[model samples]
Target: MRIPVKHPWTLPKRLLGTFVILASIGRIQSEQKSSKQPNIVVIVADDLGWNDVSFHGADQIPTPNIDALAYNGVILNRHYVLPTCTPSRTAFFTGRYPIRTGMQGKPLSVGEPRGIPLNVRLLPEHLRNLGYRTRLVGKWHVGYYTNEHTPTRRGFESFYGHYSGYISYFNYTISKNNHTGFDLHQDTASTLEMRRNSNYATDVFTEEAVKVIENHDATEPLYLHLAHPAPHSSEAKEVVEVRNMSEVNSRFGYIENINRRKFAGMMMALDQSVGRIVKALGDANMLDNSIIVFMADNGAQTEGFLENYGSNYPLRGLKFTHYDGGVRGVACIYSPLIKNNSRVSEQLLHVTDWLPTFYSLAGGDVNDLGDIDGLDQWSAISLAENSARESLLINIDDAVNLRGVVSGKFKLIEGAADLYGNYYGDTGNNNSYPEYNITEILESDAGLAITSIGNSLLTETKILNLRSASIVRCNNFTDFANCSDTCLFNLQNDPCETTDVSADYPEIFISLSKMIEIFESELVPQTNTDVDPASYPEKFNGFWMPWVASDSSTIIATSSLIGLINILLHIFSLIFFS
Candidate 1:
């Protein structure tokens, strides 16, 4: 101690040097992270089915572009989502369980005066804070009752999509409560030009996405949320609009069901859209530094509300039920950064994970997201590490008294007996489905782009391995013959949820039941309000818009006064400087 006191200046200098070295290391790390920030592109397919993409062993449909990406990327075999669109999207955007936001019920109707609460920051907002340019194209069914609820207000710099749950592909019309109106908009303003042009929504969204990529300042990271309206039937639940009917008829002639045939065509456009998006990224020189996440918002609506004629064949239940078919989605991630490629990941994941996952990937701390249901799964996803998730709160719909939870390999569901809790299967064998020319698809503009940046060549063996690993076979257990209200199933043994194991595994069932009770205690009351007539699109130029109005005239007056003051200040500055 006496020796150090005799050399006080030297000790202080040593401490200062240490501090500088630490700061330098931190700065270097920050710079390295900043340089490695990948452009994030999340492509969400609306109402796509589990057995829809060819990679998932479906012969009825050929998603070549989608398959190319899946084969080149990691297929998320056990990716789970909420049962329907809004709830799934809410989880994706908010990083919280829908139950926390009181959005665990049905999709938001046209005029509900509620949305993902504004106080809670959204994914785009967090990304924007980290210097990413965020844009949204396609469906924005989260909320739009107030001016503050739209995408642009929430964080998206540009919003080119519909505000309602679903809209017509060509006409951009949405109908609800016997009121039909235009639903397309370009950041709060009705995209009347698009309506007049009558472009297919998928094609339109693709073009806009391409434009966003092409026109982007590449120095800045991009977060493009391409939420397609394809395959999600229009509100009419009968219309399936595609760019070319002749091509649809020729390409999907083998499909027996007419509705499914239309859906196939719709999916064709969506697949092509994916191709073009990949091509655009390549053209823009962003593919090598990009992460493309392709996922269906939820399982298909094969026969329920907004029935798109999509099939979740070989899985139990459809969109609104608690079964795997309802929540298990078709999802995959393609990126040059993924250390694990051309494989199937059995690790359990949920829709809510995207927020923290993407945020972490963008070099932000997941802890900043704070107490959300989502776990930072970036490492688990990219490095093939085990997922941080131990369990999934599939949903807790208090309004319907339905609750579901998945822990380990067992899943428990209560209040879903009357729902479509039956296993469904397609006749096509997983081992033997109609094969496409891999060379032809892999050589296409999109295929080449995706393959160049992803796992080298898409060989037959790789394709076979991907298919073999991802194929869900329900040969042994064909159906959930009679599921009780509180049914439990070992999903690992019976992925299709064929047998109710609640009585057999009483301990596991009771443990999951208790977990559900704990979640139920934290349930936020569902804010299901009746349609506010004032929000009718008829009042605001035939577009589904923010009808709450929010004192526009007062805002305009204040803005004008502020502009006048700014001009005066500028004049004064000029005089003073001169």
Candidate 2:
């Protein structure tokens, strides 16, 4: 103990000790932060309108849990997606435009012969390759006519829901003339048809999601896509009904309209489901560390009469249009990695941008994305200086009349629109609304910017309802290039595409036109354009059979008879031998 204080190595030894302690602490912190990449829980609601949530200034029904999520995270004010379901979902999975995937302006019906396309790698496939357990707990409207096109065959290790845009919450059965069967499924097999139960889809799906979170392997990161079909539609075809009738009176008894009341109840249930999932994560000790993304596939169908009676109020257009109301959605990303919370982001975030973003967060190299449309936005959403994407290639439906793109504050819309805000069919000079210049509509204090879409018998039918207001006619041409109309607007000054700045800014118009041309060139030829869904290939073979029919009692009786006969034969044989 006689070491002198004047020793040469004394100060150096003390500094070395300090450095070692600091290094160990840094390592521990890094380990805790980067344990196994945050679990990605993407909760998508079908047809959730812009003004649907309480945070979006809606007093009809307060989505407190959902509002809490938005307040605790960042509100994606400029988030954009496709006008329809399958198209947006296609863009989400492939990290490419829906036009490229042949789902440009239409959704895959009960038995469309085409889907995500073979040789295409989905978000789940890429994540699964990286040892992530991918689970899809709801709607998969992309495709399902064949076993190969099913969700389980795609990328998800497990899938538990319907293969269509929407389904009945209770009966779980659909009867569309020649196109009818059980919709619920576990993996590829129809669950409702197999087990035959009476459970509301929303509740059953929530329970399944909780199970997925609880039973997840902690060693691997998880990608759970809980897509809820709520406030969308039921078997009644664009008719809204709440699965939980008890909640209707409790949450929205004051709503005078039965349709609106049912919608409010469904929305309440959806909010409760979000809370349940959040709590489940907490129970599993994965809450604080998990990254939850809450968003909708597309805007709600607000412009159609008796069509989902949902409202995207304040936003100009409805579903199946190029209006901000149709494409823009309510979205938020919550995680500890995000530095700024309880704020709004004006950056242009696209649905296609999620694949690369999630992949980047999961420790995958962004360079491996490879020509994918989805840019890695991990840093941007994580409180980085700027988001990875500045502008978005908003909508590109060459098959129709209405389509546009968002660059900075400039938006170029090229098409005609009917009173319903849909450009699908010909308006025929009746109540022809301005698709490009809606400055008054956007600035007005009107209840709804647009009126109800009253289609004839062609309602919710095919896209070929030429006389109906579903299409812009396109010279009634079946070719993709027939949509030659165009309009441009400055969304900054005119949030409604009101002012025809296209004539003023010829350069911008030409630039957007060039981009659209290039994107269209890359688009795959359209498929599943058949007028009748029943005529789609492989319509009957193994798909048309009702897996859980009401007459299944006959099959059970037959099985019992066979069993009795077999037992009698065995006993008689034994007696004869004795």
Candidate 3:
């Protein structure tokens, strides 16, 4: 059967031109929704190492999905984050250094009243103002002392995850100071009964993220922050949790260390989660109009309390120290909008930059975010321009007597950082797995972007080019053994702070030290309070909850009702069994 068509000769030329104009206008209207505000998906991996991902030249455990994303995007070579989770998150959310908000201290402890200061606005709140539906899944470690500090109150429309730093993979429980409590929740309500058997935290978060993406309204832009807790150790005594023992044994048989093997499995789970989330976006037809940003919160805890045995490899120092290993994180940005893709960017980008950067990307005025430490670098990232950021105030904690600042290529450090400052991991380029082709990953839906950019298929040559451009190969300097206070190292020459060049370059040292002094002047005194016994989980029916906030009444009422039922059950047990 021949398909009937409107004959061109049937209408006048002017009328036909009018019809063409109308059709073009209709097409423009249909595409305007996505073109106006693209969906923003920021996936944060907790405590991931600099050398852990395969893109960074690690081969022991393959992260094909992550590598595919990186290869299709710009691999951030000099991306700097804080040395720990809480501070890093504070910077990312607020687009300001932690020092400005008194969040410069350690991670928010259990029952601590301190949070990203209530006065300081967050990224989600700004995105929300731009008519974006904001949702957070997985870790909310910045703060949860009060109802106002929680994700829902802090700009996210919905929250589905734990309130604390880390929780058990299966049970969703956190242990601190010999006290155990259920931390999993679905927007201020404890998800105790909703917990699925054998459902790991990483998998659960991934499912929730995919659901959010699938169910999201296409008209309204979505800002989904999927913060995965995998690779970050749980609060329990058995820190690392590996759901698939069989796969761990088979895939990571080369790794002799038990914790490292477990870490590899956790990474595998996270990589799978990344793949699934991207697939969900593609399945929903949101890929072309979406931007995916993947980054580790901070560096890995190589060997310490709550260590997952992650490797920073050639980079010196562990999670708590101010070294490239701890601060220089794994990061990338993948989107069709980006002109510069499938390359490594050596631009200096700080965690705080994301706030203004993302806001500008969402078509918001940077002036609205007044006096923020984060500089907008959307142009620098997307167009491969020189970064707006020239220097980075690494950190300053007077309590610990530690301070660090990076100016140009020179980095200045003071206080005791030598304890964990040593090269880690022997498996740098041991077993390179280049078999996971970026073009073959149909789930990620990044191949089209790669091929569209002048027929680049993310080939082996391009992968090597990207990896070589990003990976920091240290010179293994064996100079003056003294690594005490007031140390200086040129990060350009010594990416690993193996040698102290402070005495050699006095002017640069003085300049960076003065830079620290300037940042210190803006520091807010730490407001972290002692753990309030009233905030204990036992008081709230074995669940971590807000205590001193106005919204505590609802939880209190629920706890009272459950307590009454428990007492009634005890009385019945005495009457029956006794």
Candidates' TM-scores?
0.88, 0.75, 0.86
Give lDDT for model 1: 0.81
Q: Determine which window of 10 residues in candidate 3 has minimal summed lDDT.
A: 1-10
- How large an RMSD does model 2 have? 19.4
By TM-score, rank the candidates, best first. Answer: 1, 3, 2
What are the clashing pairs of model 3?
Answer: none
Identify the superior model by TM-score, candidate 1 or candidate 2.
Answer: 1
Computed on alpha carbons, the lDDT of every model, listed in order, comes to 0.81, 0.65, 0.79
lDDT of 2: 0.65
Which one wins on TM-score?
1
* Model number with the top lDDT: 1
lDDT per residue as tens, model 2, 1-578: 01112233444687656545544554343344345678899999998887676555445665656655555566777789888888889899989887676678677766455677644668887676454789999888887654656777677989988777777777665555455566677886543254366677788899999999999876567889999987677766436767667767765666766777777788878877887787677667676667889998888775463267677765656777777778888787766557765466767789999999888787666676567888887767767447677666766666664567778878776774654553221111212211221222122211011111111111112211211221111122222222235667666666644446677898988988887777767877666554345433244433332122223344334433443343333334323432
Candidate 3 lDDT by residue in tens digits, 1-578:
00112254565798667656654554344345335788999999999998888788766677877887888888998999998889999999988888888888788887777787665668887776555799999999888877767888778999999878888998888766777788888998885586554588899999999999989987778999999987998865568888878888888777777888888899989988888887787778777778899999888888876788898877887887888888988899888778887888989999999888888877666886779889988888889999999999888877788889888788888884676777665454544433434344423434443343443456667877886787777775444335667789888888878788888999888888788888888888877677777888888888888877554445444433443343333334323433
Q: State the lDDT of candidate 1 residue by residue for 1-578, as single tens digits.
A: 00002222444687656645554554444444555789999999988889888888766677888888888888999899999889999999999999898899988898888898766678987777565799999899999987767898777999988887788777788776777788888987875565696877888889999999999988778999999987788754456676787887888777666777788899888888999999999988899999999999888877755677788888888888889999999999988888878889999999999999898889776776678999888888888999989899999988888899999899999888565666543544344435555675677666899766645667888787788789888746654647657789899889888888887999998899999999999999998889998878788778778878655455444434443343333334323432
lDDT of 3 at 517: 82
Q: Spell out the clash pairs found in candidate 1.
A: 314-424
Candidate 1: worst-modelled 10 consecutive residues by lDDT: 1-10
